[model samples]
Target chain A: MTNMALYKREMKGSIKLLVIFSAVITLYVSIIIGMYDPELMKTLDGFVEAMPELMASVGMKADAATLLGFMVSYLYGFILLIFPMLFCILRGNALIAKYVDKGSMALLTAAPVKRRTIAFTQMKVLVSGILLLILYSTILEFICAESGFPGELDITSLIMLNGGLLCLHLFIGSICFLSSCLFSDTKYSIGFGAGIPILMYVLQMLANVGGDAETAKYFTFFTLFHPDGIIAGESQAAVSSLILLAGAIILYALGIIIFDRKDLHL
Target chain B: MSIIKVERLVRDYGGGKGVFDVSFHVDQGEAFGFLGPNGAGKTTTIRHLMGFLKPASGECSINGLDCWRERDKVQANLGYIPGEISFFEDLSGTEFLKFIAEYRKIGIQNRREELLERFELDPRNKIKKMSKGMKQKLGIVAAFMHDPDILILDEPTSGLDPLMQNRFIDLIAEEKKHGKTILMSSHMFEEVERTCDRIGIIRKGRMVAVDAAASLRERHTRSYTVTLESESAAEAFAIDFNGMRKGLKVTVTTKQSLEEIFMNYYGGEKHDEHGAV
Candidate 1:
């Protein structure tokens, strides 16, 4: 189908917000990292041990017991997941729910486009916006690393970590898309969109802290893309990330199908 | 051929309210008006015809194609202006129009300039900055820009000034001349009387009447007020009028037109009391 028009329109409308958000996040992370002097082993040790708990809360891993590991864990665990999720929530809320809420869906549904085409185009815009944010964060990470912090910057591992994070974000985006299709109210869509990830994050944290419920970790995309898991060279996490990414694609497909068949009243 | 047909269409909003078993047809090149007061299911009927809402029972078809089953094809042949025209506030009017044009895959081809001049709209202004009437004008222009075979307008002139309303009527007339079918839903009786070839009056989720405007007026029971020179004369006239009545009912009273009563009680200079006296 000729769905590029909607995709282009959505992309143009959302890219500016994504850029501004990424810039703000990068600046904030840079300042936090700048305050650390990684040469102090005692201070570094304290930071590392504390970092794992923080990462765990943010749906990251607690296995990173070193400065670099802590930094990667924090970045991957909290910043990466939280930022893109916020992006997804905002974009997803606006995509379907906002149109329905504002009665603009009447106009769109009356046009020559199919409902599937509309959903797919919205997904394309969301995925593209998220990918751009990932790209910006990766570039910013490298720039921060080169700013002469006293730690060994493992560029390859960081790249892999961010790549995994991107996959997780894509999964979150799909979740948001599905939720958006399910809800007609934009506020409710956003609530569920952001809430689902946080719920998963909490579940993962509980699985970690509760010890016996580690199996629950497998249910979350965050668990699959944990930074410490990747740093420890655990192939399981990488495999799981791939599986979750596949799940994301399936969710997005389902969202489009549901949108197509369901009645859209405006 | 009928460009639009709705048969036993039932749409419920889950709260026990919506259009129920509504059936109507709009022939090719006809200006059809769906008229009702507020909460009369007019918008609901239009929404089903546009394929935005699926009927709970029965069907809606546009140009002989099922609206729900053959949506894309049906929609391609129609232009629609919704009741509420909210746009992406961040985009300029030019950008919004360009986006729609691209989607429709039709070049503006001087249509933009013509419509802009006709509506006095500035293409450069962001949608958020424009007034409600300006936005409505933009929607009207966008709906017509592609020059589709049918135009479905819901409350098209709600926010327009009298001048713009006249321009809108003229635009519809032009479309009619070009043989474009129109299905318009509105609450304004005068507009329906002025432009529609046929009208369907919906009340309480059912079509109460559908006929030519003149026929509707003729069918409606009208009230007549008759004033006599005196109360006794009024009583006598009332008895005579009742005996002579064909359809209209006449009420005889000492009541006078406010203007005439005012002229009698508060006499002023003829020029000052009434214009061009």
Candidate 2:
């Protein structure tokens, strides 16, 4: 179903970007975990009360009774979402659309390999990239929390939170991959691939602001991930994660089929 | 049986912009030249043979297998050099070749090494930093390294210097001698005249002519412009030679080279327009 040589080539080509993103995200996770002080939370609550709308709009809250809640409110709201989304958008576009747009796809297609195999290999590269990024942050979070405030974080809730985060990113990466496959031009691929996810993140933020803006969540895929609910180990979070995983599978499959059937102008 | 075949292949891109009712075949161990000017659907037709495209109507097959349905099987014994050569820019030339070898599961590196030396391509430099001619040489090496039975090359010598072009033409001639079936699309008449057994000239998505290379040259009548001292003398000379007279010039047709015949096919309508005026 996939070509291992192509998989290795793609993985090698994208490894630098993955490493850079992983390092940056893990750094952010460590810093956030390190800053999980109850005294600082009390002070932050004072500012949160002063600027409730502004803080809420960014998915930030100082109302945390545990280390995991503090981490979720600070990191999952923006840093975690934006960084990995950037990786997905850029890496996804580079995986397929970049080669086609630059006319290098002819080299691959000229080989005996099927188009389906090439697409499948690229998908594996992308999916693995997202997994590694999420996994790196998850491990770093554990290491940081255990060393800094041992036993302060709930093991089950933290696992559930990271699981939901993984599913959400996989879904976002698939959206980028589909758009990448749909357009033969990088500008258009990046435009829609990067555009849609960033839009969803903004909507998620606006929905978090509460009141009339709450309906905006319905329009965004990001709403499927409720960091607070996942941290509380809600069944709804698990179902939403499953839905995200399902959507990712469908989008990836559609991308592969479309690439196999489309006419390549290369 | 034909080693490669296209039966009434039609891919309409609309507004008369695509190949229409295009048909041709290459027998085993024959070199067929596909000649066309820019935007003449040369690459479009070749794309179908490579199975990168499905024809709107009709079909293309290689070794009796449908090109589109069994592309992988077809490509297994086929090599292709696309009109535009682009590569993985980040990889060094050596790395790209190794990658292709691994991708194709080629165990023997002898042919690849020989081609690299013949082309004088230093695979040490990153492809992004290499010159266009170097990249072209790399494309040629990668396409031929597998030593496939069928080779489809589009403008294979486009960016090469005259020396390298001659080398490529010689290479094609040698490959033809080895009984490789080659379908080469080119704009250069000299290379085709030197290497191809037959030539097919395509213009405006239609095959204007397909004939033996030697016959296309032999059958074409060359046009010459004879200058006289006066318009009367030119008119007198034109009548004697049964040529057209314009001022002090008398145009006569004699023997044409392959280049002129190709020009006639490509610019035939424009030439007729000028004659009408």
Candidate 3:
């Protein structure tokens, strides 16, 4: 549905940011992979024993002996999820909504290309960005894990963990992307686009406090991708992955449909 | 055949706003000027023709295709500069033009270069940094660079200095000479008078007058402010021509043209005498 020129242009516009995001994710994942200390792993259970509530509140695992447990608690639970989610919210809003609001989309719309073609092309940019980020971080972390732990790491489980994260980010990105198309003014669109994901992130955090708020975790999309569950090869990873994939497809289709029919006030 | 056609187009924006039952047509190789004051539905009408807005009741088309349904096909023949020019301000003008050309599939740079040189525009500067006139110049080049058959410009000369405005007028004249169809909306009477073969004046979302430029001008009455050597001479001249006299001066409004007729019908303040003028 899209011409090569448009796809290439969209890619060219964001390749710089893609490279920067990949580099940052790779660096963080590599540092986490290298931070596996077997000696520190044995004594780690004592801290959890001392203050179980405080440890759970901060998303710290009591048993951080194994490399997988350390990474699940130290990296995937917060930094990795939050970083990609932020990237998706920012870039997804910029991809469509900001362009339409600023009248730059007018320039593209005046051309021979269809609105769907423009949309699909930008979607490629977004999907490719997420894919490349995952690819870079996974490869870099794999190399670090192999050298640091030497065959002790379950490679398949690690791949599944990253895959779950990818699906989660795509779902988050699509929410922002859809919100961007829903309104003409940036104030409203940006409010919805950025607001929803941040709300979900906060809900997940409060849910982890493990009291009355524990049930609130069920409400957020984040509940699907439990870092420790993913590293342990739990069923939640597989189920959440499917749900995120379905939600992402629906939101993206809605974005294109609304964008095609809505009046461009520009 | 008409290159651009708008029929019974009504788009109510609420609170008594938006265009109402607007209808007009511009034939092939004809320049039609749409004249209206601020908020008089000129831009709305142009946007309809551009397929940017869907009418509430009626429809508009270019080259016989439905404006909304077949906009992609219709846009192939159209070149436009929106009322408010907006661009990718982060990119330099040259890059932005190149991006448009790439989308337009115009591999040749001659026309784009010629337009840049004609407008005295150096498209190397960032669009955010460019002055309004320069951005307007860039918009003109981007629109004309493709050499489209139809041009839809809304207030194309609003931000430009007078010299650039004249340059734009000359450009339109050249485009007109090439047998191109153009619909331009503007507040300036002289530019429309100079370039358009026919002119339509719209007021409050309603088209008040439409006529051939030559006939509209020839039939219009002229206004002359004459100074007399004597006070009695002024009063005598006023009496003779049905003009008004004040302190040795006689002010006589000209014959009513299509413009005067429009104003007269609306009973505006500037030209108050309806029957007398």
Candidate 2 residue-wise lDDT, B56-108, digit = tens? 99999999999998999999999889888989888999999999999988877
Estimate every model's Cα lDDT from 0 to 1: 0.76, 0.87, 0.81
- Highest DockQ against the true fold, candidate: 2
Q: Estimate each model's TM-score.
A: 0.83, 0.91, 0.89
Write down the worst ten-residue block by lDDT for model 1 chain B: B268-277
Best of the candidates, lDDT: 2
- Screening candidate 3 with a backbone cut-off below 3 angstroms (N, C-alpha, C), the clashing residue pairs are B220-B257, B221-B254, B221-B255, B221-B256, B222-B254, B222-B255, B223-B254
Better of 1 and 3 by TM-score: 3
Residues A52-145, candidate 3: write the lDDT tens digits.
6666655766667567677777677676777777777777878888887887788888877777777777777777777777777778777888
Give the chain B TM-score for each candidate.
Answer: 0.79, 0.83, 0.84
Name model 1 segments beyond 4 Å from true. A28-38, A47-70, A143-156, A205-220, B14-16, B221-277
Ranking by TM-score: 2, 3, 1
For every candidate in turn, the CA RMSD to the true structure comes to 9.4, 6.1, 5.6
